[model samples]
Target: MSAPAYSRPAPESNQGVLLARRLLPPVLREWVERLGGELATVCGYQLGLCDDRGKPTGGVGGKLLRPAFTLLCGAATGARPADVVPAGAAIELLHNASLIHDDIMDGDRERRHRPTVWARFGEATAILAGDALIALGFEVLAAQRHAATARSVEVLAKTLRLLARGQELDLRFESEARVSVDECLTMMTGKTGVLLGCACRLGAAHSGAPAEWAVRFERFGVHLGVAFQLADDLLGIWGDPAVTGKPVGADLLARKKSAPVAAALSAGTTGSARIAALYARPGQLTGAEVDQLTELIEEAGGRDWTIAEADRQVSAAWDLIDGLDLDGPARSSLATLTGTLLNRDH
Candidate 1:
């Protein structure tokens, strides 16, 4: 099943990616080396800083969206980019840790066009690498001597708890006969939104923004995060595998109840009934069956519903940004970055 011929205009260059490429490598390299020996090597490979043979790859790593938000929000508060490096590093490490663990749990073999950590380095090594990353994230935050250091650590801890709860709900949803759209949204907020919100809040707080302004930044990030997850769900079903760096229909093939699938199943239409029947079948779905399920889900209005919701979330986020008392350039950059994220195909 080919995705519809829908395309978004590409940003000339993603400001977030540019910031991450400039700021993250040295920090990641120094901390990852602290792990020592095999653990250090595995973690480095997972972060795309080095090859499996432990040689430097000069890779810029993943999108680094969370860290980019941290840096941008910090800049909004008049902090120098270097001043927020610790916070950005902490968020990026935690994000990668979650990815490693998620790949192991979901049995995904590839990410960012390379074999996942668990696939290339074995599950036990991947687990250790993920744990090490978490420890490193806390260490980075704790090393900060600012007054907001303790509060930043606390925020990151809370985000981790929410992330774990989200993952648990996600796993549980796979076994349940039905899941409400509201429940799915809650799960995604915990799994994806809080961390991004935390990134923004930490940025503002650590950079000396007033408490009230930090709260507003957090709200803006939460909305943006929801929009990001909705976009990801759409990509899971219809995205080009080459662009997404995963197999086509990977979520559908695994029988995971993604947001669109849940919406389709709960639509209560004839197409919904057919989708449910297809999902309820015992064994793995063949390619043709997967294609049929994709068409039925779109026919049942799941695709349109998700697209509309994503747009709504993005608009809400932009409104929040507009109300902030940020400098004109910072405000524009944040809004532009949000659009870049919303328009991404991967």
Candidate 2:
């Protein structure tokens, strides 16, 4: 197949994107080239490797955070980043696959300033593309020659199961009259945390780190993932659309019981009662109501609570990293990357 013609410059500011540029492109190219059909076309479009017309766009896909964690954690075991490319690539592919399905489930038309795969193509095609990506993730990992390959595959499989369960819980929240903050946190951990933990564990395992060290790395990633999701929840309701690439209050429109929403609903404030009553009456909330809901969440202390909790999680992750006896520079890189993710606007 001839190479498609177009190239866009990647953003130079983020460390995760820089590291992923070194690791993901080759694997992504292989997937696009090897699939070689409608599956290839859909996957390519979904991944930002190409446009809907099957022309290469040089797009870099999502933030590449999971793969960056994989590579950085592997480096802690004194392995070169190159040595763990398969693990990083596997985690990345899985993460994108999840995003493809998630956009469909959330009924989101736009992500990263473009139509989502399901919106651009059709739902059936997007589902197939997501499935293909999941299989490719395992295929990439299984091809690795490391002793930890089998174990890594097992971890990946478990993470997928957890992701499915998490999605189930999220869907359930939409219709249920009441959702506790604790339930919301558990759902977030399952949906977001396990995959990141899998990324870190795969990295450490592939690099021949001891089992205990791998567990520690996984825990660190779990904490970081929670912080990441909390930040995302804040953005879902209040973020600038130009920066976040999605409409502000999109989650509120969907009646999603996000962390902040759940926190507000569970609080005993009068604002909380108003929010619950509004949520209970809704067909779809008007734009004005979404604006009101945003304020209600804040007034109920949900916004403040989420911000503090995210900070606490980040501190916990840092403490765990400090206790680990790892390569010094790799540890520093991990810390920098964590700060970058927590502070991002999008």
Candidate 3:
């Protein structure tokens, strides 16, 4: 597939994304690229391919959402947005590290509209690349003489632990049945939510914001992360392949137990039973089977239930933000950013 850059919707007119852009030093972007290239080079050497020629792997990257969160949180915390660049780069690197392993675990060949690292470089190399990035993240943080408050380090470590626990739970879910909605939520929070919380907390720490403000920021990020994950689950089921960057019903084909699937199973309807039967099979799913499962979950109200839950989480996140003494161009920009997230097509 082509490696054209993926595009996101324009931020709201009132959004500070552009303002954040203005505040961001171009060096931050360059640093992220440099770090990524270093990690890739290490992977190439480890794989005995350092000198091999091939099409440049230009697009195994995402929207860098985590780093953006860190930068915005810094702005909201009264820090010069440029000051958090290292932390922002670290957050983005951490995310890509996780994604590298995730694609291997899911046996996926494509991500961000390009061949996944594992697909292009082999599984062992990809796994090592992910490990290298994780180590490099800590190295970056340690080397950031200008930032790196003790609290930021603490939050980052805690987030990393949570992410590990979440991934463990996700792997466990594949083999275990009877996953409750609560369990799934807890898993999502740990796996996806904590890192976002860490991103915001790191930003707040960078600015020397009051401890209470960091707490509130953490809460905001946690809730937003949950909502984002839920929306992602919904997309996995109902989204168009062209936009979602995957085959339609890819989740069903993998027999992955996402929120909607778990909700449908809990509904205990006949359709749910039919869907369960389809999932019980242990091999490649036919197109007919994929459609059948999607329909079964939608018919069982899983689709509606999951979407409602996502909206609730998103609203709760913003509600926390609303209570904060956040007003001004920065706050307006955040509001715009949140709205954009809620309505994203992919």
Candidate 4:
């Protein structure tokens, strides 16, 4: 059920471009592992005697995209390649904290191919763990005394706030009949875009780049984030179950207010109305019903619309990257990464 005429490929291995790939040799892995372990401990909390879904869920952590961006920014700015280690770890911890909380709010059971922390540990514990991770992420960076500590702190704080607001907007959208395009863009910026921007900014901070390049790098990340989200939304609708690790039509099944679904609904096409009718019904929908909904979404042109949007953002990201005043392999690495993220299958 992949998007027709648009075969999104699996993201290539990071071996060539990512700071982690370059730095995670055995010795470096030890430090990353140590920092991760410490982060988990800092985030661990006893959820009282009572068990509830409010406790943390358990799963493998996220892909650490933000941290990687930060490290790459550092490399671009002339920081020693080795400096990415602590910086990446810190960024990863912060991202994981958001994921822990996000799962609880979304009541998601699965993440990274495992039960969510809230689903496994209970929501109460999960929330505590999330808070702990947030603190630990900054602590790790603070302890390292990286030259960019102050700048990193500022960026991290802003990123957290933006993430929270993004989640809030997502929740708010659940009850609305329609979200204006501007509002939709704003919500995405908060939910998915800003953190990536922060990652790039943190990296550049470490590199001691001029303020102007940091801004440009951040913009590049923002464009990348928007394109990444659009690709993800497209996948949620039409991706292969084997590749996406979720059932077909899972977003429709969950009644998620994703961009494609939203677009289809706004178009008010016949197929779109039929899908809405099916969605409005109570209890779990049958397999046939889910398929019907998928067809309707496609017929309404939601899939193609989102794909075009993804391409647009990718173009914008490339433009931003091209404008950056960067040097050598570091510049080339970021470009490769941008292309990789733009074309991922999952």
**lDDT tens readout by residue for model 3, 207-292:** 76777887877888898888878877876777667766668777888787899999998899999888888888778999888887
Q: Please name the candidate that would achieve the greatest lDDT relative to the true structure.
A: 1
Cα TM-score per model:
0.92, 0.90, 0.82, 0.83
Candidate 2 stretches greater than 4 Å from native = 1-12, 283-288, 344-346
| Candidate models: Cα lDDT each | 0.83, 0.81, 0.70, 0.68
- Candidate that beats the other on lDDT, 2 or 3, i.e. the better one: 2
- Tens digits of per-residue lDDT for model 1 on 1-346? 5553332444436565578678888998999999998989889988888988899998655767788888888888887887788889999899889999999998889887789999999999999999999999999989977788987898899998899999999989989877777888899888888889988888888877788777777777888898888878887888777666657777789887888988988899999989888889999899999899899989998888888888887777667667667766666677787777677443
Q: What is the lDDT of residue 163 in candidate 4?
A: 90
The number of clashing residue pairs in each candidate reads 0, 0, 1, 20
User: Per-residue error at 292 for model 3, in Å?
Assistant: 3.2
Model 2 lDDT per residue over 1-346, tens place: 1121111222445454578776687788786677888888788877778888888877656767788888888887777786678888888888889989999998989887789999988899889889999999999889887788787889899999999999899888877988998898889888998999898888888777787777878888888898889988877787666566657677788777888898999998899999998888848788888888888998898888898888988888777767667888777777777766666332
- C-alpha-based local distance difference test score of model 3: 0.70
Candidates in order: C-alpha RMSD to true structure = 2.3, 6.6, 5.4, 5.3
Name the 10 consecutive residues with the lowest summed lDDT in model 1: 3-12
User: Which residue ranges in model 3 land beyond 4 Å of their true spot?
Assistant: 1-60, 146-148, 344-346
The parts of candidate 1 lying over 4 Å away from their true place are 1-12, 245-248, 344-346
